[model samples]
Each structure stands twice: as structure tokens, then as C-alpha cells.
Target chain A: MAKKFLQRLGLKDKLLAIIVPLLVLAAWQGAVSQKLCSELILTPPLTLLNTLLELAQSGDLTLNILASLKRVMIGFLLGGTSGFVIGILMALSPFLNRIFGPLIKALQQVPEFAWMPLIIMFLGIDEFAKYFFVAIGAFYPMVLNTYQGVSGVPEKYHELARVFDYKSFRYLFKVIIPSALPSIITGIRLSLGLSWMFVVGAELFGSDSGVGYLMTWGRAVFQIDLVMAGLILVGVIGFAMNFLLERAEKQFLLWREPVDGRPA
Target chain B: MSNNKGTLEIRNLSKSFIVDNSPLQILNNINLTVTSGSFVSIVGSSGCGKTTLLRIILGLENHYDGEALMDGKQIVGPGTNRGIVFQDHRLLPWLTVGENVAFGLDKLNRKEKKLLVDEHLQLVGLIGFESVYPSQLSGGMAQRVAIARALANKPEMLLLDEPLGALDALTRMYMQKELERLWQLEKITMIMVTHDIEEAIYLSDKVVIMSSRPGIIKQIIDVSSSRPRDRASSEFMQIKAEILEEFHLGTEYTFAYAI
Candidate 1:
């Protein structure tokens, strides 16, 4: 009986969510038919859909998708790993925090795209430059999140672990890391989003291939359809990445739920 | 480490907390001994340093003067031999019930660790909840899991800092009975710090009544009742009255209040 009520509540929420998006899409299609705005300013939804279909049929789309994905994966791994290590070190020792904290914070203040010119100058407008930008974009969030996660662990849990004779690595991995994971996940989500933005900006600067480069190519040739396609693809891919991260979070962080069967 | 069996002897134990510019004295000239496998409950008013005393005993606080000797060896820090359950369950939110129980068993092999966790979960009547997380548990249930986790270490002494203070009255009663059963079956020492006077009288072999402010042992009363104490017994009420008077709470406050 209770399960039925909860399922009904869930269905209601799902229905409510679908309603707005569907209405927006319909309004978009109407605006295109009526020529509500200049075609240059606002491409029709059907035209955008048709362009997406054309890209899909051409097979160039796959290469572009793969290029963006590879860059994100590499940059994400490098940035996330380094950030995690440095964050944990900073959390464990005040001396390390004092030495590196100011420098990292200063660097973080500059947006990831702001470093693109310097990176392009140093790395010479190659793939490495793009990867480096994505990495920097991904790095700050990971480190800051990790530091907060580790340092924010309750003193009570530390006391409990000590009483249990958990010292050294045993105490760190078993207690400290697990206690700090929710914050770590939040950081990861933020960095992942930033990486998408950085990869697009990198492609815009001077890449021969990738989604961002394709969008720039379309813009140079006055192929607004292709640009629209690239924009849609980026939005979809970013959304998918975020969705996957949310699912993983639900699976991994079950213990954080409240007593009333709601997510904490 | 010296060996003297399971005697817990505290010699001239004094603890103070630094507040603002001055030191605030908590436990002053505290001296107490708890025999092995004995159930000792310390009852006191609010801010009486009951929790502080427990923290010192558990080796979580080290700024105190004097010594806490477990079996003649001075306690320098927390040890596996002394396990604690705080008023809150304090179960790690990222771990499942079985994993939380196995948190202290980092040294044990996987198979042995699983067995120990399972055994303690069963001991607490939480056998089928092995896969469930702490967030899915009730207040009483979560506290039981905390108890199970502490017991999985097989500690020589279990320090409970008001383990049942957060539970409802009915659940607290149920947990009290369950605790008494576990204490008798496991036969490990228990030192509980609680504000519940009736709970102290009902569960403890000896009740140590403590005074407020600069916390000090006001009286130590030995309950001569047989095991599985009847709450309705006159002897139980009399001891409860005595302990209440020691803290100036009066016998009228002994009537069971919802936890």
C-alpha cells in the first residue's frame, strides 16, 4: 500500500518534468513556422533536428564525438588524480597547506580559458594545448573539493577510529576517505562540467578536428545548421555525462540518505 | 605494557578544559577502579564531565594529569582493547551495515572479518540488516548497529557514552534489556555514562553518582540485586532514590521520563 503511494508520487513528479520541455519544444516549432524571430537569430527546432540527422548520416559526427570524449577522458583523469593527491596532502599537513594553498587559489582565480593564450604560446597550438586547458579547468574543482572533504570530517569519527586502533593507512582509507567522499563527488561533478566547456574553447582556438573545431568551421562557412548541430550535440553530451555521474553517486553514496527514505 | 589482569585503575585523574583565557576544571582528583566483566554505570547531571571522563578513559583526550591504567599499563592512547559507542550511532554514512561493523577489523582476513561482522549483527538482532545502510535504520536500530560494531572488535572494555540517550522511551527499554543480555553473554567490562538515573539503577552492578560543575564522585552505590533486575522491585527504587539525592535531583525526578 505504501509502495503504491510512493510510486504514484514519483510518477507525478516525472509527468510534471516532461510537461514543460514538451511545451517548450512545441512553442519552438511554432516560432519557426511563423518566422517569429529572424532565421539567423533563432533556427527552427525541425531545421536543427534535420541538421542533426544529416551530421549523423555523414559519419563525420562520430569522429568529432570521439575526439571530444578522448580529450575529456585524458584531461579529467590527469586533473582529477593530481588534485586528489595534492588535496589530501594539504588536508593532512598545515605546512603543505601554507606552502601550496595560496598559489593554487591564485591560479584558480583566473578562469581556465584565461590561460589558453599562454598555453597556446608555450605548447604551440597543438593537441597538448587543448588537453592542458581542459586539465586546468578540471583541476581546481577537484583539489578544492578534496581538501574540503578530508578536512571537514567530524572529529568524533577520528576519535572513534583511534579508539578502534585504526592508525596510519588503515585509518585514512577506511575512515577519512569514505567520510569525505560526498564532497569529493561534488567536486568531480563540477570539474567534469568545466572540462566540457574547456574542450569546446580549446577547439575554437586552433584545432583541426573535434566538436569545437567543427562548430568553428561551420561558422566560417556560414553553415548555421552545422553550428546549431554542434551546439545541440555538446548540450546532449554534457547532460549525459552529468546524468551518469548522478547515477553513480546514487549507487555509491546510499548511506547518506535520511531515515525517511529521502536523499540527504 | 604491564599485566595485572583486567583491573582498570585510575590514579589521581584530573582533567581541565581551556576556555577563553582560563582553565575550566572538569574532573577533579578522580580516582576509580572497575573490576573485569563488571557493569559500571556513572550517573550525573548535565555538564558534569561524565562524557569527558569517558573520553579520557577511552584515550581520546590526553591533556589530563594523572594516570588511567588498564591492567597496570598506563593508557597513552586509544587501544582496540577499549571500544566506545557515543550517544549518536556515529556509523559512517558511506558504509553498509556489514561494512560499518567491519570498520575496526582492518587487520582481520576477509573471511574472518565477515564472520565477526555477521556474528555481532546477529548478536544485536540485526542479522537480516547486513546489507542495509545506517540512514535506513531507526534511532534504536542505528544504536544497536553501533553496539554491534564496537563488540566486533571484541574489546576487553566497552565504554558507552549515553548509548541510549537518543532513543525513545520504549526503544530505550528494549535496548536496556538487550544490553544486559549482551553484557552477561559476552562477559566484557562495561562503563556507561548516562543522565538516566533509572537506567543506571536497572542495568549497572554498581552506580557511581557524580556531582555537577567541577565534576566529582559524590557516591558509589553497590546494587545487590540478582541478574535480570525487576524494575518494580522496592530495592531498585530505593537505590534510584539514593543516587538522585546524591545529585540533589530528588526522588520525584526518578519517575521514568521519555528519553
Candidate 2:
């Protein structure tokens, strides 16, 4: 009965999700009006909104966003493609799996930021260093997810391929890859989030141009409003990217039945 | 060597499995012959090696010591000439009914593939469900699509491993009639492994009864009844009684321990 009631109140549930955020914003405004927190530390929501508008009007916001987006695209393409290839190869061959499996596991244990200092020293704090960091962040999850996806394909599908006498290429593309696609898409989504997080870490140390750099610049100048605005923009963009990818996943996996047996 | 195009001859077939460091035999000295354009059923209780025998004939298991020959050629491994439908309708979940049927016809041109798939879908009475996915179909419909997929290859011999075993009794009965109709229409050699004695008698030209514990053929009873034979007929009852007697399930047991 409760499930049916909840299902009927779908729109209300969506509205309810925003209630906590609204209450927090109201409390923040109250604190700022009463001067409970200094502007240098907190930078109340209205002041941050004004700073965001000013930055947008001056074109600084668009420039930083474009720069960061460019870095993410290049790093994502290089990391995602290589990881996909390597993952498939490892799953296909036992020799490669045995050789690289332990090495990858060890690398994954090290945080993406841990390599920042050494990478900057090698590449000299240029665009290449940032790209490398983001790529590294994206690569590990992609590889692990792809390997799991490919290896987890049902043995029965392989038997069907054999019975049909399918060619190797056809079998791989039609059976193995499609069967593993849901897991692969999930990995790609995770890598996308990692790339965003790594971009911030990459820019926090030594960069002049990207959204991450803008936040650091605001911190150095003691412009707390600008910093808060930058953080909000980053969060909004990440949320938007995730939403878009979820839609794409739905489009690609139309054949999957909904777990709750709901109509499409 | 059998002169008929679809004749399958199995000779001195035996299979064993390594269980806990000891060799356990599964099928022992099994031999059977299925002629062209005939339906043969292997009926036995679970663990009677009926499925193992089908797997051997399909050439999925090469470890068995025997010769399974089709049209005078020794079977080696899975080939397109032999199509199979497993007990669980192993259709690819990502594909629609039409695509699943066309899966085995990869060598055919696109137009030819479509035509064959459509024809077989119609043959299995699933003509309007071409675009539907397997998950959306009922158990019986899914099994029919599996049948269509198997027949799409136009194989010389079709192997079914209890194809309707997962369906309800009503659906099973309907599918049994459908199987008979399909056999009459297609005229291909078919070998089905089933647990239902009545089902075996209803659809098959010959019922091969097997015994458990290193499974071997106990008897092969030929059904000389004509097509559309009545299930309640005296002849049908006689054949059913004979098969039940082999399994020690005959009517004689009812009065054996009378109070």
C-alpha cells in the first residue's frame, strides 16, 4: 500500500527532494543577515549570485568553462579509448591478464592526486600535465569496469555463438560487446566524474586558465564570493553531464526490462 | 553409413565425468538410429543421460567414446547443419524475435535472411511478435521463438533438450500439438529429450526409453499410429502402458499391494 501511494505521488516526491536544500539556503540567508559569519569566510548566497552574474557578463565565466571543457574532452577521449582497448585485450588473452592484472590493481590503490607533483615535475605544469592527470583518473576505472564487463558475459551466449558457427569478429561485436555494454556504460559514466574531479586537482596546484584556476585565484585574492560561485558552477556542470549520460544509457539499452516491471 | 540425407546413427556411445578424482560413467553403450524426416523422442527420468546423449549428437561434447554420424559423415563439433533449442529458450536478450531468428542466418543475404526469419516466425505462430524482445514474451512464446530460430537455419537435423519443459501443462499441451504440426510441415529429422511419456508418444514416431545409473537404452518403441492420432485411443493407452511398465509405473502396481 505504501509503495502504491509513493508511486502515485511521483511529482510530489521530486518536489520533496528539494525541501532540505531550500531550508539550508534559508538558514544561510538568516545567518548572513544577522552577521553571524564573516563575508570573507561564508559569502552569503545573494552576494555569490551577484558575483556569478558579473563574471558571466564580463565573459570570464564562459572562457574558464570552455578551457576546462576542452581539457576534459581531450583527456577523456585518450583515456577512455586506450582503457577500452586494453581491457578487451586483457579479457581476451590470459597471458596479458596475468601480466597486467596485479600492476593495475596496485596503480588503482594510489590516489589520482598522489601523482600530481611528480607529473608536474616531469611535464612542467603545462596543459599536458593537467591532461595527463585527468587521463590517469579516467583510465583506471574504465579498465577495471571493461574487464569485469567482458569477463562476466554468460557462458551460454558463447555456446550460442559456437552453435551458430559465428565468425570471431561477429561473435565479439554482436554477442560479447553488446552483452557487456551496460557495465561498460557504467564505467564510462564513472570515468567522466573522475575526469571532472581530477581537473580541479590538476588546476589547484599551478594553472592560470580553467574553472579550477578561477577558484584558486579567488582564494588568493580573498574574494570568497567568486570562490563560492566557481564551486557552484562546477557542481552544476557535473550534475548536467551525469544527467545527459544517463539519458544516453537509457537510449542504448532499450532492450533491458525495467527491474520493477514498470512500462517504458 | 545411412543413405538418407538426414539419417543419424549413434554407435557404442559412452561418456564419463571426473567427479572427486574418480571416473563416473554418465552414458553407457547407447545406440540409436533416427531416419530422415522422422521425429524421435528420448524419454527418461532426470539424471538418465538423455540430455548428454543429445549433446553428443550435437557434437558439443567430443570426450565421449562413440561415433555419431549424419549422412555418413562423422560428427566432430558444432556446425550450422545441426540446429539446437535448449530447454530454457537461450535467445539473446538484446535482440528482437526477428533478429534472434536471423542470428543463425548470418551467411545469407539480408533480404534472404529476413524472408527466412519471417517464414519461420509464421511457422511457429509468432508472426506478429517480430519486433518484441524475449523478456516481453511469455514462456511458451519464447520457446516458440527458439523453435523458429532453430528452424531458421534449415538444418538437416534439429535437437531439442526438453524444449517445452518450462511451460505450464496447458501451454505444454498446446506446444506439443504445435511441434507435431511443425514436424509434419518441415520434414526434418528431430531428436527431443523429454520426461513426459505421453508427450513422447504424442509427437514422436519412436520413443527411446532409457534407464538410470550409467544411463543406457532400455527399449525403443515404434509408434505405428497415423497422424492426428487420438490421445484417448486404446492403442495410445497400450503404448503409454508399455512405457510406464518399463519405468515400473504400470497399472499393475495399483493392485500389487491391495489391502
Interface RMSD of each: 2.9, 3.9
The list of candidate 2 runs beyond 4 A from truth reads A1-11, A260-264, B1-3, B253-259
Evaluated on CA atoms against the true complex, candidate 1 attains a DockQ of 0.52
| Local error of candidate 2 at residue A15 (angstroms) | 0.3
lDDT of 2 by residue, B1-259 (tens): 1336678998998999999999999999988889998899999999999998998888888897888887788888898778899998998988999999999988899999989988999899899898988888888999999999999998888999999998899999999999888888888888999999889999989999999999999999999898787777778888888999999888864333321
For all predicted structures, in order, the TM-scores are 0.90, 0.94
Clashes of each: 0, 0
Residue pairs with clashing backbones, model 1: none
DockQ result, candidate 2: 0.47
Per-residue lDDT for A1-264 in model 2, tens only? 865776686647666568758888889978988999876789888888899999999999999999999889888877887888889889988999999988999988987778977997899899988888899988987898999999998888888888888767898899999999998999899999889888877888889988999999999998888788989989999999999999999999888876867221
Quality class of the docking in candidate 1, CAPRI style: medium
> A1-264, model 1: which lDDT tens digit per residue?
755885676756577578768889789879878878777767777888888777779988898989998898888888888998899999989999999999999987887677877897899888777778888888999999999999999997887777777778988888889899999999999899989978988899888888998899999998887898899899989999999999998778767887566321
Tens-digit lDDT string for candidate 1 (B132-151): 98888888888999999999
